[model samples]
Structure formats: C-alpha cells, structure tokens
Target: MSAFDGVKVAVLLFVAAIAQVSIFGQLHVFGAVPDILLVTLVAISLLRGSVAGAVGGFFAGLIVDTASLGTLGLTSLVLTLSGFWIGRYGETTGRDRAHAPYLSIAVVTVLYELGLLVVHFVLGESAPAGAVVRSLLPAVVLNLIVTGPVYGLVRRLLRAMERQELSAEVQLLG
Candidate 1:
C-alpha cells in the first residue's frame, strides 16, 4: 500500500480506538458492552493482512491495557494474535462464500476470549471459568451478529479500490 493506504488505516484505527473507548464501551445494551475494538481489529485483519492485523491488535491492546489498568501488553498480545489469525484466515480461505465472515468471527471470538483468560492467568489474575464463559459467549454472539454488515461495507470499499487499481493498471498497459 502507498502512503495513502497507510494513512487511511491509521485514521481508521484511531477512529476505532476513540469509538471503542468513548462510544462503544459506555453503551450498555441491557448491560452487554459492545466489543467494538475487537470487532474492528477483526475487520481490519480480514480486510488488510496479518501485519496490519497484528499492528492494529497491538495498538488496540495497548489502549485497552492503559484504559483497564491491567498489564501493559496483555490485550496487545491477545489482539495481535487474533488479528494474525484472521489475516491468515483471509489468506488461506477464498472469500467467495457468503457465510465465511460470520462463521469465522464466531469461531475466532471464543478463541480470543480463551486467549485473554490465559493472559489473565499468566498475569496472576484468576477468573472463574463461569465468568470467562459469561463474558466471552455474549461478546462472541454479538460480534457474529455484527460481522455481516461490517464485512459487507469493508468488502465493498476494498472491491472499489481494487477496481480503481485495476483500471489504472490497464491504462498503463495500453
């Protein structure tokens, strides 16, 4: 990507961070907080790549770490891995199927929670299994529900950009 793409990504990440911190977390849907950053990281990874995903995860995690007052790299590490996995998912699987994003988010959501639980354990903070389950399951379901629309919007932007690039390439060739 050129500087333009890089800047776009950074702006989106910043917006996502701000939204996650100021907007999403505070919005209680019957006491269920939206995992806006996590979902954004997931979308970024799928739309971008593993490196982008990892970077997004790292920064997002740093924000969470700072906000929550937990260990510095806990969220950074977990979200980085999640982004990496999603990027890998994008590479390994073709995106022709309509069901892919929803399914992928559903599976990745559980794994992300488990990874966070492990991080908490390593950090010497013990959470009851029930608490972990409670926090994770709802977040996963909500993410799955939200993934479809988000993916559609992201994919459309990507496709439009690709078309522009393709047109430029054709013109150069001619």
Candidate 2:
C-alpha cells in the first residue's frame, strides 16, 4: 500500500477505536455491545491483506488499550490474530464472495470473544463462560447487522484510494 493509503487506514482505525470505546462500548443490545473496531479492522484487513491487517489491528488495539486504561497488549494480541486470519481468509477463499464481509464478521466475533475468554482465564481473571456464551450469538448478529454498511464504506474508500494511486502511477509513467 502507498503511504497515503496507510495513513488513511490508520486514521480510519483510529476513529474506529475511538468510537468503539466511547460510543459503542455503552450501546448494549440484549447485553451484547457491537465491536465497531473489530468490524472495521476486519473490513480493512480484507481489503489490504494480512500484513497490513495485522499492523492495523495492533495499532488500533494499542490505542484502545491506552485509551481505556485496560491491560496492555490484551486487545492488541486478540485483534492482531483476528486481523491476520481474516486477511488470510480474504486473500484465499472469501475475497470475491459477496457475503465475505458478513461471514467474516460473524465468525470473527465468535472467535474474538472466545479468545478474550481464554486470555482472561489464563490471566487469572474470571472467564465467565456463561456470560460469554450468552452474549456470543447476540454479538455476532449485531456485528453482522453492521458489517454490510461498514465494509461497504471501507471498500469504497479503499477503491477510491487505489484508483488515485493507479492514476498517479500512470501519470508518472506517461
């Protein structure tokens, strides 16, 4: 990706992180809050590729951790994995599928929540299985509901950026 693209991705993730913490964090629907950052990260990772996704995930997670004053590296690790694997899925089977974004978000939401449970358990924190189980499906549905619009927006932005990059390259060559 070009430097400008990277900047755009970074800014996008930054805004997503802020919204995840400040807005969506409190918006609970059936006791399941939508993870805007995760959905956004997955969208970007799908468009950009694995390395970019991993980097974006890490950066966004770090910002979230710092902003929320949570345990350092907790979200970073989870989102890094989320982004990387989602990117791989995009690069492989799902890239061209019309349902890829919704599928990715649903699957990742389940896995991400499970991963958080494992991390919390390993860290000697109470990994409330009941809570996780109860919220998991609802969260997946909520994420899927938003995935369409969020992914569409990100895809449009990336396509526009890609077109600009290609036009610039053509100009330089001409």
Candidate 3:
C-alpha cells in the first residue's frame, strides 16, 4: 500500500480507537459493549491485506492500551491475531462473499473474547468464566450490529481513496 494509504489507515484506526474507548466502551447494552475498534480493524483488514491488518491491529491495540491504561500489549496481541487471520480470510475466501463481514465479525467476536479470557487467566487475573459466558452472546450480537455499517463505511472510504489515487496515477502516466 501507499504511504498515504498507511496514513489513512492510521487515522481511521485512531478515530475508531478513540470512539471505542470514550464512547462504545461506556455504552454497555445487555451486559456488552460494541467493539467499534475491532469491527473497524476487521473492515480495514478485509479491504487491505494481512500485513496491513496486523500492523493496524497492533497500533490500534496500543492506542486502546495507552488510552485505557490497561495492560500494554494485551489488546495488541489479540488484535494482531484477529487482524492477521481475518485479513488472511479476506485474502483467501471472504473478500467477495456477501456475508463475509457479518460472519467475520461474529466469529472474531467470539474468538477475541475467548482470547481475552485466556490471556487474563494466563496472567493470573480474575478471569470470570461465568461473566464471559453470560456476556458472550450479547457481545457477539452487538459486534454484528456494528460490523455492517462500519464495514460499509470503511470499504467505501478505501475504495474511493484508492480510486482517486489510481486515476491520479493514470493521469500522470498519460
């Protein structure tokens, strides 16, 4: 990707990170909050590629970690994995599929939460199994709800920007 594309990804992730921490993180519904950052990362990764997705995930996780003042690399690790695999999925199978975004969001939501629990357990933190189980369904549903609009917007933004760049390149070459 172009440097401009990287910058755009960064800005987009930055906005999503801020919104996730400041807004979505606080807006708990049915014992779960919508993970705007995760959904955004998934959308971008799907549009871009695995490398971009992994990089975006790492930085976005860092932003969340620093913003929330929680464990530093925790979110990064999860997001990195989510971003990489999701991007690979996009690259391989899901990119053209109509239900890719929804399926990706749902599957990743579950894996992300489970990964969180595992990490917490490994870290000797109070990993509440009951709470995780109880909130799993709601979180999945909330994430699915978020995945649609966010994915559409991200897809539109990337395509428009890329199209503009392509046309500019063509003009210059002509």
lDDT of 1 by residue, 67-149 (tens): 76778998888888988888888767834556667777888788888888887877778856676677776777777777777
Task: Report the error of model 2 at residue 4, Å.
Answer: 0.5
**Candidates' C-alpha lDDT:** 0.74, 0.93, 0.94
Q: Which 10 consecutive positions of candidate 3 have the poorest summed lDDT?
A: 156-165
In model 3, the Cα lDDT at residue 77 comes to 99
The residue ranges of model 3 lying beyond 4 angstroms of the native Cα positions read 164-174
lDDT of 2 by residue, 4-62 (tens): 88998999999999999999999999989999999999999899889989999999999
Question: Any residue pairs clashing in model 1, and if so which?
Answer: none
> Each prediction's TM-score against the native?
0.84, 0.94, 0.93
List runs of model 1 lying over 4 Å from the truth: 28-32, 170-174
Give every collision pair in model 3: none
lDDT, candidate 3, 1-174, per-residue tens: 888888889999999999999999999898889999999999998989899999999999999999999999999999999999999999999988989999999999999999999999999999998898899999999998878889988888789777887899999999
Deviation from native of the Cα of residue 129 in model 1, angstroms:
2.1
Candidate 2 lDDT score at position 164 = 85
Error of 3 at 156 (Å): 1.1
What is candidate 1's TM-score against the reference? 0.84
Ranking by TM-score: 2, 3, 1
For each predicted model, how many residue pairs clash, with residues at least 3 apart or on different chains?
Answer: 0, 0, 0
Top candidate (TM-score): 2
